[model samples]
Target chain A: MTINKELMKGSTVILILTLLDRKPMYGYEMSKEMEKSSSGVLTLKEGTLYPILHTLESDGMVESYWSSGEGERKRKYYQITKKGQGLLKEKQREWISFRTAVDQVLGGGPA
Target chain B: MTINKELMKGSTVILILTLLDRKPMYGYEMSKEMEKSSSGVLTLKEGTLYPILHTLESDGMVESYWSSGEGERKRKYYQITKKGQGLLKEKQREWISFRTAVDQVLGGGPA
Candidate 1:
């Protein structure tokens, strides 16, 4: 199936926010979680995910801290801020409404 | 009725890309289209849409031109580039797969 860039642009922010909502996670962990959650269908590259993490951090929606890991690797673990939580809630409502409209247009039920 | 920021982040890119797929639009038009398409559910602010549009333009995914209008308003119209088209296709596939997984986890069918 063809993936649309426009769609990704609309949704990536919310996806990242939702993932971070669970717990503080480093870039690698986030990517791994996405893969696991999506059953390997939503693999996130470091290149794509890192920039997003940085952007979210700058936006004050997420916070990060450095933590040491095995093999002496220092990873920046990110967690959602209260602001991020609020933003997440707002986006969720928007998405539901958006989905409902799209579904209606596509001749589907409100589900 | 809470909106999830995480969900929005994940999908906003695709939404923008898909909208542009329909026609070249300026920031205001894009916001309006989102509202119309989502039945007034996904209203985008200039604060949000402008930055995204600028970023997309800079990334070479979208190209823009100035178009003058009545009342001395000169609007910038943006069109997706070939690269943007390619990116859109990739994202569409990713969203489909991601949605499929999310549905499975949520105990829903692969609808």
Candidate 2:
């Protein structure tokens, strides 16, 4: 199924926060994890993902640091901050409310 | 709950179509119904709602006409077009897929 670009755009911050909530990750690793986790249903492009990362960082929702893991070249890894976590919780709530509202109207209701 | 403006922006079209799918509605009526039905989780301002309606009208997903019913003054009412219905189905599928993918990562799974 074709993913709605608009919806994806709206959920970008939450998606990034959700992934980073587990552990810190670099951009490529994060995108790969998202693809795998979504079972290829949501493949995020680097172009689409990086700018958003930068925005999140600037917004103080996320922070970045150099990571030089064993046998791997140094890369910038992103992690959600305490502020980010709170924002993530807020976002999650909003998503749930929006989903419930939409489902109520779209699902088994008077038609 | 604080509704994410970004997320709300993304789902505006879907929400409007879902309501219009039930029956034709005017601007004020649509906003009121959305607030009432969402249990006030979403309170769409007329300014925010109208621009979206205009965009949808331009996209041909919906059409508008002047309606005068009973004692009410003439008002512009909107209804979903065939294209809009097709789009609604696509949006529904996309929302489901997105929600499922999100649930997988956010739920009690490998962390």
Candidate 3:
């Protein structure tokens, strides 16, 4: 099912950090990997991806470096920093708590 | 744990609708019940609560009416409309899909 954009907004940073936590990847590669792994459920638009990346970089959560690919294409690759990893862990914990909280409300009805 | 406000933004509507789905409640009652049922994990601030209710009412998802509670205090109670229930079901499904998607991305790593 297509997710609401507003709902999707909260997840973008964590998603990016999770991907980078695995290995460094350029923007297009990360986007494709997310879509493929999620079975097209989470499509990160390029426009949205770049700004978040920039923000994360500014916040020192991630760092970007330029590298030349096989086709001599220069791409900016993002790698998770120590700070990013820490934030990723925190975000993961928060996500679990948030999910559980939401489930509690959704299932409990009125109390 | 206190959820990040950004993450919390996406869930307010679903949470509010879920409560009303069980029974109608005034603003304060709903807020208190949400905190109680979630064991204080989900706290709905009154400021954030009213605007969403107003939006839901305007969108025909919920309707509100004033009622006299104890001490003869008039309060506006909100109840879910048919449209709200429909939206709630859809939001629930989307939430599941989203949770699944995030899990896929988080666990699969570089796919």
Best by TM-score: 3
- Candidate 2 vs candidate 3: which has greater TM-score? 3
Q: Which stretches of candidate 2 lie over 4 Å from their true place?
A: A58-61, A69-71, B58-60, B108-110
Q: TM-scores for all candidates? A: 0.54, 0.84, 0.93
**TM-score of chain B, candidates 1 onward in order:** 0.85, 0.89, 0.90
lDDT of 2 by residue, B40-106 (tens): 7776789999998999999999999998679979999999999999998888877788778767766
lDDT of 2 by residue, A1-111 (tens): 547677776777777789999988899998899888878777678998999999989999999999867998989999989999999898888778877876765663444
Alpha-carbon deviation at A7 in model 2, angstroms: 0.5
Give the Cα-based TM-score of candidate 1 against the true structure: 0.54
Model 3 chain A: worst 10 consecutive residues (lDDT sum): A1-10
DockQ sort, best first: 3, 2, 1
Show model 3 residue runs off by greater than 4 Å: A69-71, B69-71
User: How would you class the docking of model 1?
Assistant: incorrect
Sort by TM-score, best first. 3, 2, 1
In order, what DockQ does each candidate have?
0.15, 0.50, 0.70
Candidate 1 RMSD to the correct structure: 8.7
